[model samples]
Target: MKMLLLRYSTAFICAVFIITGAVSGEDKAVGQTVSFRPDKIVTPVSSIIWKHRSSTGSVVKAIEWDVDDGDNIPNPRFKGITTLDQKTGEITITKLTVEHSGVYTIDINSKEHEQRFTLNVMERVPKPEITIEESSNPDVVYLRCAYSEKIIWKKSSGETLNGMKNQDPGEFITVKNTRNPENFYTCTLKNAVSEEISDPVTERELFGTGEDKAVGQTVSFRPDKIVPPVSSIIWKHRSSTGSVIKVIEWDAEDGDNIPNPRFKGITTLDEKTGEITITKLTVEHSGVYTIDINGKEHEQRFTLTVMERVSKPKMTIEVSSNPDVVYLRCAYSEKIIWKNSSGETLEGKKNHELGEFITVENTGNPENFYTCTLKNAVSEEISDPVSEREIFRTGEDKAVGQTVSFRPDKIVTPVSSIIWKHRSSTGSVVKAIEWDVDDGDNIPNPRFKGITTLDRKTGQITITNLIIEHSGVYTIDINSKEQEQRFTLTVMERVPKPKMTIEVSSNPDVAYLRCAYNEMIIWKNSSGETLNGTKNHDPGEYIMVKNTRNPENFYTCTLKNAVSEEISDPVTEREIFGTGSNAGMIVAIVIVVFIVIAVIAIVLSYLIMKTVHESVNNICPCIPNIFGPLDCLLKKTDREPKNSAPNDVASPLNETAP
Candidate 1:
């Protein structure tokens, strides 16, 4: 029975041992799974350890943890798991940075088990530096804020900023704002982890404000503070209607934003240093401006004043022939006065009190100056002096037998009279003729021989039927000056009647006769009866005519003048028949010719003789004996007759002459 109890106990103990062993194996597996542990997490870096026992013995794998920041983190450098010694479960990370901070996961059996731990990176933003740009007027000032990182800008006044990224280095963010006589401005900058602010800056309004800004002058306003990155600075203007006029805007990284129409193409902004320049300012650009930085707002007002310049003045003076009449005119909006070289004002005229034009009369030998003074509400200017010289005496000279006239160089003054004085060749003054003279008793020259007459009121002297002896210089005293002019007389003889002659051609159709005086043809005739021709002939008609059947056929002209008259001897025409005709036929032809010539020859016989003589003179001397019909039949020439009749009378046609 004791042996049976021992067997049962052994069986019971064996079963218990098997059950305990299985439980222990399960605990060891659980312990192995929980063995990996991270003691400390370095920002951006994580570590993990793995413990596992194989069928032969226990083993350990040191693993590095993979970390990732959430949601599209840029610039991720380190990734994946790192392996360590298989015998040890120690894991560690050396480098710590912003990118190494996130959830980490382990990879096993194609499945991922993740462990998350956020690594918060602490970042500090430096204070931003602030600067203001100078403007033509102090009312407007440009502000700039600069920082190191992409920072946020906020205003204390609850103003939201348009966030900027990657602020450029060494660049200024600018804002255009107003400067108030008593106002302070403040700005602030902030980053994801840290924030900074600038000290308050104060500014005063410019003095003396108006619409008329002086050209070529400047006004400046500078703020005192350091600005921060991520902050925006703006320059704005508040209209009377309460509208905000944004002039300029500066971002932490981006340089500036200037509004159109106001600063477009007219303003310049610097990125290296925050500054703005507005060039060529005009009157229309003047206005109030506002400056906004962070959350602070400021205002400054300015007025421009302009000055005026004086214009030049002009003056003119006029004087009359009478020496007493004087006129002065000023062609300007100013006061004028007349003065003399003696430094005294003529006629006691006063400034601005004198008329624009003034006239003075009945004054003698007056010397004066014309002065014009121009003035405005602010200043006064004067014109150069205009002067007039004095004249003591003036008069005119007169000619005999001509109307007495006077041409004075200047206008005559009122109540002034001219005096006349006449002197003879004997140097004695003459006052007697048939006129009354206002002279101290005077005597006439002996050469005058009581033949001279003078009109005192008319200033005329008449010497009837002037002779050669009367030619001399006559003197007349006008005012205080003596004027002498000379005179000469000429005589002419009467002209005699002109003599005239007539000329006729055998053809009665070719030559023309005329009378002329001084080479001018006065009358002309072609046949015995007056022909249609002009007289007063030119020198070209003076020569004798050729190709005449009868040399005596006169082509005569007359010359006449007022002194004398001359006439050429009358020209006569002869008849001839050709040899082919008999005597009876020629005689019959001659009778017919005579009948036809009767109309031209009946007026004058002297004309016929003169024509015959001229015809004979034109023939060659060797042909002197040549008779009309006989010379033609014999073909022989004769010398001209030496003893020619003074007037060769034509044979009577009614009876034949032997």
Candidate 2:
């Protein structure tokens, strides 16, 4: 048995370390094998002695071994179960029982060694199972384990939790919802020697829903069909898993009785009406609540589901330019509605059910104000009103000395008259273009006379040769009626085609590039992917060449403005920094240096060999061994004497000591 343990000694120790943390005093379950190794010095001893000390300090000699003699077990209790190695002084005990737990020590020769071990033998832990107490709100729940020993809670996500306390000793633990219903939870019962984990439980398995209610809310169950002066009223609850418990019971003579402790203080029963009210609800209160009036069971029952309060939602706006449509989006997924200024629900305006957004057409009415309401079973919130002007105002940017057309949202054919008015930045309004069915087009302002034209049929106005002074809001009128949708334009100087300038910095691996424009610069590679380089004040940007890995890719800088954009000519890193020529030169220099080093090494080695050869020839010329300088010197002294040695060759003592 000792030999068998020795074969797998390394594996046994590793297993113990992984299970028990390899402490000096390790814990083990009953019916297991334990090896006590002498951690101190065990060598140069003529004999080895092992002893056991109990918890009461009583000591007994377990085993003794002699290097020359055999081994003996002094304690008969350890005779068949314990074994000690005579060579290594290691002790092994198999099939351990609780009585074998105590302090153990080994003695080298006669004196005890410093190394001491403690063994704890205990029974295996029993596997525990979890019990659940439901809550009215899914966010809070109570879980239970029955073990009184050390308890540990664990999430399936490998999250370690601090030690948890049981609300009722070893029975209940309050668990707040972490909003991760997919993650499962388990509890472990641990002691000094053993630990066992319970099966996992998830929120979905613990809670179910029907009619939802919020925590701290109240709910009533009524069964008033019985005649006045009812004899009994009983309210019973059945959990989703089919467990039945009494919520409240009342008898005309016995008064009221709330059997379950979970509903004691907060549950009420009205005798005359047979109505049961439960307030300050928790997730544990969620279940099917049924009532019986005057000893007669009512078929009607209520299934209550508890949930967290819904969050308030915010409304967002998105405007489509081409179709001129406004989208009102509520930031919530469900229970969304849109209302107008008169508080009338706009039905049929919902774009789709998947996305909580509704479309508002460009009705050209400034009074088109809308609000979105987001609601859940527990709460509702209405967004602030959004006006149509905020949604329908169209903005356009034009460059100076450029032509632009101001077209209405819709075309009005066979127009009687058309007028285009401009509101300048100073709030001054003027007619820029005017036309009538009886007369041709006319420009009212001298600055716009030769540059503006109005389309008589479509009521569209075109302004040519724009300048910075033309920047303002333009409103259109057709058939003597003004439209609500207006156009806001801003004119600025156009961006010039950027010129790329490159400057190599002191660092050989990087170069600085400048676009020579004041506008925003975007650097892009040949693949059009944006490049983020270190920013510089004057030289624009500092980009790495060698570290980029693709030094041959062409790069361009795009200068942009609200009105126009231009891109600089593409340039490669190699062209900017001349790294290609520099790399070739560096390679050539390294090759030359290596060649010089090789030639110098060869000459030095040849000189050293020549010097050694000359010294060997001067010391002894009769030696012919040249494989090594040392071999030649040793051979010269050990050469056989040619005059005599026939007897010396045959004698064993004459052979050289190797």
Candidate 3:
């Protein structure tokens, strides 16, 4: 009985230890989320209850849910921060704090599950800093860390110093001066939840480091040491070719002086510290610099390489004969790099072929953008983003007489050279317009002589007074790269307005109506019905119609082409007949009136002539002479005896006339 009791007690204690060891715990930073899930699967009808034990050992029911009653949280503090999943029996707490850190347990269907969680919320460790302190030895210093938590010392390469992982909480560590320019160190504050690392400090920063500068940049050089009340200071520069130039000269009484003309206006000197600063540096200012104090040179010398800033890069695209390949060339530079839209560097030989330019395959995706960067030691410039889609475009359809303009998707400014070509419908190509920096616009084809205009800056061509012959493919080449996009144009003709005319036959009742236009003609009556007509002299130029006396029976002629249509003014049949009859009657009346007036004038002329002749005979009884004077008057004046009988008759006539 004693052995049985001892074995049962031991078994009970072992079971309790196993149950306690089943709970899980994790360390979470402040403001982080933690989740506790039940070990067994949860069903819709299963009841769930969640409870939490605070750090102070107080227990409380946090949430309760079942199929009958939805879900309820008793504690208002956890109202917004806690979420419960009824189906999965998962409890999630967000934005956790130290006050909320405790053990969490879930009971499903009135039975506590084996799954348990303990959350330990902690704040992030403070960032560690290395405070340097002077040691008694001249060649050594003490680097002290400042943090409440564990300290981790690392070199610039991220390796632990002296192969030590986490160091015990300590204040300072001794370091010997190595005089190596590549030496750098950092410290980190680490905890269970989070860690913070300090910025890297280099040994050269404590000493002095050489600098590289570009044009228009400023630089300062400080000596290693300077005695108080320095008598004289001189800053000197030595070029790479071993030529020395006096950069600055200063004295206690004589002030400062800069002898070099290149550093006259842009150089400054500190007399007390023997320090010199050069502003607005140029490439010519590149050299080894040093300072002198009290007739003795400073210990350290600074070497500076002043380079020119990189020029702004320009991108040019060239399309290959293959539709899927394109070449991108950047402005000339010693070093070039290519990048995609996502800012990832592309492999040189794998992703693109390297030559004078970069060649890439067009995958027909416009989202794949590329940029080129021109880089040197001092500066870099990136070109604008370019895509293959921007280098090619589709065609447009246009009307026959429209003034059309062909604009490229991408316009290269400051264009050095450009050429515009056209492919006719018969597969013949010709240069429409060309221009270059040396020569102005030159139009080679006579057809485009007066109508084509090319833009020098945009590489665009505008063709005015467009004709049917201009309906072909047009292309442009800028800086020797022919564009793949073709401006295909289809020109259609427009119909003109139609005119109607009437002609009369020999018969009074017969009249013909004609419609005049150089296109398909449709004849419509007043009832809006199509009429058939015989073809006229030319195709689609004329239409015929018969004349009707009805006033309401009006006719219209419509001229139509593939692109346009126009209708003539409505004309009535009675108007047509009236036109012919009125014209004929007017002619007949004009002829009859003219003949009557002519006959009356002839009768009056004859009567007047007879009266005149009788009067002449009564007056002189002789005819008038044609070339000479009257013969009877002449005879009467010449001889009176021969004209005695005439004189006696004339005397009786003259008396009667008087």
Candidate 4:
């Protein structure tokens, strides 16, 4: 019974243990615990705890965690929670604040264990206030980004800003604080899990005054007030359209080096002294020049101007004879002052003055030199001296009948008129033909009545139909003062008839002969006979023969005087018709043969007519007088006496006619 009671107790105790183990295994499968800190910031040597728990009753292995804060985080630190373990089972946060308070979770396999913690860390350091020193200086301005604790400066546009710990009260945040009105700056202070932001600070830049001037003008630009330590001063130019033309860069200690396109190779800049010089200024170099002092822009404009020069004057003179009749002309551009060699001033019409042309007349001189002085308002000039000795002897000559001619040494505009006079036998000046022609003129004496022809362009004269009474010694004068030339005139009687002779032909078979009296065919003859071969008889016929084959003969022409009845013989040899010795005989034989043939043809024709008439009479015996004698002869047959023929026949038969 004792062994039985012991076994039952052991079974009951083992059952209780099994139930507990099953419940614990279920808890380990369903529950989780995540470890994290409540606050991250604390003084050095402060108690830092590593706390963790598990949801299941199973014993859990304890693991350590890492810590980080604003000093170790990347730029732009913020208050937030970050997991220390890759499994996100533990978390360590810096500068904890309400922003760092959140529920953290730990993941185990596929299960999550979470814990909500309120981080109560110390407040983060306050952001320092920012201020700009020398905000109105055109050269440079100071910008300060400050905070109560170590703060990081940043640009609103995400630019990493340089920072200095415990900067002086007025020290600038950026090394070269070139201020731009458009830049937005801010400062942020961060502690463990806590951060503070400061309002943005901007540096106000003062713009420099601008001016424009001509390129050659002196330019001087100085600041309104001296700068302390004199930071970098730069010069820049802005174009008329508000664009950057050039940037003037200069070191405060070394000075400036400014380059401009207009001043390329022609301008120099001083690096030790900020001085710019441009030699040989040109108008094209006009533009705006800018000076940039520490990124401050100032500008000035330049302009330029220019002028022209003057020229000299010229003069010419023309002199003429016959002072009272012809005119003298002088031409000049500037104002002219005429003076004679005798220190006498000559006055005349001031024809034209305005640099166009001028003419003066009647300035007569015998031995004086004429000086023409042309003067302008600024200067006075004189032409080369013209002497009267050059005009003492007029360059003109005259002759009677021959043309009176005048030729000047030089061609002068506005020609001078030529004057002419003529003297008669009485030694008195008389006007006969006082008219002007081209190249010459005709001025005949009053007593001269002959026809005179003058060619003015050629200076030629011709006189026609002169009478004995018109003969005389005539003198022709030119230009009045020039000497005259004398010429004697004589008239003659009429012309007589010319002597002449007639020519005749010695051979009868050759050409005809004729005579001309003063080129007039007065008489003509052929062969040796003359049948009324005189002017009174037209188409006179004598003995003439045509040489059909050859011609070789001599002709004799006798001319009888109309008053003396005397005959004059002039002979001419007939030309041979052909090159042969018996040319005359051949011609005569050919003529004779032609005549005989013609006579025989005529006789044969007459015989035929007689036969035809007889035949007609025989055919019609009743027709009266149809045959006349020819028919009558035909009617008488052989029985009729041969003397019974007509007596006009002059034949034996005609004498024997009844």
Candidate 5:
């Protein structure tokens, strides 16, 4: 209980001091956030008021309140920009601008309940830099840590030195520098609001590792010891000619560092440790490097080699004159090897060929994929997977004679070279051409020598007399100084329209549709469902439409061959119906002919009876006579009914008069 009371008393005393002039100011960088309260304990708070005072003891923002006059009214000028916590009386200001830098006071409920917070929002202090200075003692290094803020010297491992942090700017730190290769130190700068750790200052060394890098790259080396009082340090390169050349020289005694004229602008040397950096390294820089420290007493050697970077190799299947053979060609500027997916090496038994061409026989494999690996002294490049299907079966068409052309969407400048290839699946690549702009003409493979023409201006190529075997993707790759163009050429099979017809059988009451072609076929209804039982749809099979519904909107027939598909237009039942049987139509014609004959005979009999009635008056009904009217009436008696003729006797009289 007494300890708790003592803690409260101490805090109360501090609060009283803040109200008086005895409050010591806290450090805060300008434009940084800082918060202070009456204490860390919560008390009864009704309303919160905040105040801002400048560093010069001038009150800037007069007042702010969470609740005043029974309304939660804040100062209207900065309304919604600042907020006060009524419960804790803590004022939070975000995005602290420069003008918000100063002492901040908070009043809880009334002006008497006041607390102070010193805020100075300022920029972060820059990191401290330690540069080596001359030291008389050979084992010690005189160093200065430079910073504008309160600086503290520390070991690079984050260990603080005794009383080193309290030192003023430009003050030097003294320590024994041993021959232990790695001595790293740094400094930390701080203010009320910001702090930063400087870059590490490690003691310079005298030796660097041997390295092998590509030409036109940077080469750097660091030594093991970089202490002050370095009497003389010189970097020398041992050239391939077995002669030593001075690259750079530094002498504490001479008060200057001098570099050799041969490496005037291409070399850089660290003043402290004698390390060297060479930019834009070339073949000439490949040699042994030596650092001579303290008049050659401590020397280290580093070996380096500058080699060329290898270009990536690209693989292409070229068409050979033999329809059953293809050539695998690789394009690169270094050594290359051709390898199949099974890891069998096809080429590269000897040195790498820039443009290597290998004749490959078509082996009827579904997948014939290959890759070309290019290698140089410094690097390796592998190409994309090249396959036979992508080469031979691309575009899936074949014609008797077709013109195949390849063109990329965009052509770039500096056209250095190009390659055209037509690879076949069943055969080898029929044609391959390696076109070099510098060579003025292309040396095409024997097969396509006379059939290929290239347009260098547009990077397009045309091949004439394209046959079925030539129905594959022709790849055109052009090499520019800055880019490569890949054009796709697909040759499709030219197929004709198929003969399709719908047939109906009246006897069986069924419909039969067939897509007649000398190839494999499949029939589909308007809704695209397969007719009959379909299995593997192999090409060149006799396919007919089965189990069909008559009067279909459309029955499409697709005839497929080895490399092409021919779909026939819809053959409706109306167009090809009644060919199977005509019994129903023949019976209907017979019935109609019989009915017409009966009607004609009846009409003639009625006319004869009427004439007889008009001529023989009342004699026919009573007695049989040998006259024309009596004979006609007797002959027609079986054919004409008694009531067959109409009762109009005037017609007969008028006919006789005419």
Candidate 6:
């Protein structure tokens, strides 16, 4: 791992000496906070030292180290404006105000523990401005808001018009006289890294009549500025479509107090005075009301603008009948509007019917999300951006080493342009094979020079050798007017069958089965029973099992990677460890040896008895006594071997290696 150094803090240590005893000052931006702290501090510090290059000529070590005290300087600029951490020996200027922009020095009573800092505080760029560039007609207006790190456009009612949150200039919104006055907008200026100033561009357009009110507040349409006669107060309503409607009529002398049927239940009127009050106001009650005096030519008009709180709009995405097209449907009893990622209106309407949905063709921008904002004649509601569901994917499971392939599910005729891309955080890199509208395309994106192949006819891509870095979503955007789509591809490595070896312990009744594989290993018997393996933090390779005299005890090992698996051949316990039956085998061998010796002795005796019998007459008569028992065996041997002795005799026993 790499280490992050405190270069900023270390530089401050050097700056303290340069400001008091040496010369020179460093520069800093105007709106950024500057802080310096020594890595180590000496305990029981005797004195606190502070000096500014221009304000103090000599070092001032006057203030004593205390938890409750701050800088003691002749210059009033930093007296109460700075904080000192007595234990850490760190000095922080809470904010870089204009008065604190200068070289500063601090010391822990000696030259060895001194620190310094310089502030050149650069000025902020400027508050954001929205310049209206009207087109040929007042209906079409182009607005440019800038002079800030980020530009956000919202209607005067706090409804954001665009979804751009970048450092780039904002996109213009066209007014359609539904959700807004349509052409009027306000922009918020934000400097993400600056230390001061967050302002909305109220001068661009008027959201309300400079009088803002929250929901659930009582509103009055009383004409306190101009008081008319009690008998001449007649209240009338003006519709947004340039029509006049009656509200309530009050004639004090005639005792005639009549109210419109729509406001009969909600409107409260003081009969003694000509004042009308609505208990609760909603968006439906937003309009202009006029109170006229019967005999006098005096009239008072109240734009009784009311606001209501609305819930977040609901949106649904579906794959259209055409595989390449998608439908996004959102509904609100109030007004509904939609904007693309770039802050441009894609599909929207102020009064969308209950069952009607919106259809949109996807754009080639790296971002894939769209927003649905709910609004009324008064206030606007915000919702999180939603992305299209990845309904189609290439059946490629990602891994370390494997081949991945993908193709579009549908194709349109007369294809003019195609944008092939790989998803990334910064932005999707376009690897299109065709970009021109009328003419065809060649290879783009140098990163895929020889690593990928694409079929121009069907837009199918086959990547030859895949690595783990290639594991992500791949997208394709066809003809300019069509919807953009994507397919996910995953790469994986192959794992070969592991080698299984059975090992025997000092005791002949125990054996262990081991496997040699990288990712994972498992040991089992022929009956598919899993043997208890040694617990290892990494991949475990060994498992113990009972070793018996029977040779049928065998183990099987299986190895696996994320995407592939392999199984090993069965190994028997007897193959690794001996059966412990060697003693019995030795006894059988000794019995066979004794039988051979007895047979040889009997054959020799029989031969002598036969010889003596044949020559009894030539020799003595006592030969029968010396070979008496052998004579009987000789008779039996004669029947066993018709031919005296075969030249080559087959062995009676066959021996095998253990």
Which has the greatest TM-score?
Answer: 2
lDDT of 3 by residue, 1-658 (tens): 6479768878998988877877888899999988887666746446888998898899887888887888888987578888898877888888888877888888888888776688899998877777777777745676777666777788764557642323644556566644444678888788899988887777666445677788899989888778787888888999978999899899888888888898999999877666689999998898778887888887787877788887777778887996557778775644678888778776443234332466777554555788888776578888888865565434544567677788787876667889999899999999999998898989989989898998787777998877888878888899888987677766667777777887777766566667766567888888888888677775554344554535457888898764578999987866766643445556798999999999677545535788744544454544545312235445646655332364365443334333
Q: Global lDDT for candidate 1?
A: 0.42
Sort the predicted structures by TM-score, highest score first: 2, 3, 6, 5, 1, 4
Among all windows of 10 consecutive residues in model 1, the one with the lowest summed lDDT is 25-34
Q: Write the per-residue lDDT of candidate 2 for residues 1-658, one digit (tens) a residue.
A: 5468656876886777755653368688898889888755556878888889988889998888877877888897788999987666789988888878898888888888766788998888799999887788755777888778788888775656664665565756677754334557898888887889999997556542235678899987666366776788889899868899999899878999999999989999878778788899998888788777777878775667666665666667876774457678876665677788777777534454444777788665556788877765666777778887677676667899888887776865667888899999999999998887788777888878888887666666788899999999999888889998788878999888888777776666666666766666788888878877666676455455442434577888887887788988888866866544455557798999999999666545535778755655554445444344456567757875433364743223234423
Which ranges of candidate 4 are over 4 A from the true structure?
1-120, 135-138, 167-172, 175-179, 205-658
Residue 32, candidate 1: Cα error in Å is 99
TM-score result, candidate 3: 0.38
The weakest ten consecutive residues by lDDT in model 5 span 648-657
Residue 569, model 4: Cα distance from true site in angstroms: 99
lDDT for each of the candidates?
A: 0.42, 0.75, 0.75, 0.42, 0.62, 0.58
How big is the positional error of residue 657 in model 3, measured in Å on the Cα after superposition? 99
> TM-scores across all candidates?
0.19, 0.42, 0.38, 0.17, 0.28, 0.31
Instruction: Kindly list the per-residue Cα lDDT of model 5 for residues 447-479, writing each as its tens digit.
Output: 666777888877677778765455544666668
**Candidate 6 residues 442-528, lDDT tens each?**
567665556677665787777766776566667777775444456655566777777777766765556666775566677788678
Candidate 2 TM-score over all chains jointly: 0.42
| lDDT: the better of candidates 3 and 5 | 3
Better of 1 and 5 by lDDT: 5
Worst lDDT run of 10 residues, candidate 4, spans: 24-33
On the 0 to 100 scale, the lDDT of residue 452 in model 1 is 56
Off by over 4 Å in 5: 1-208, 225-229, 255-259, 297-299, 316-322, 331-333, 337-347, 351-368, 394-658
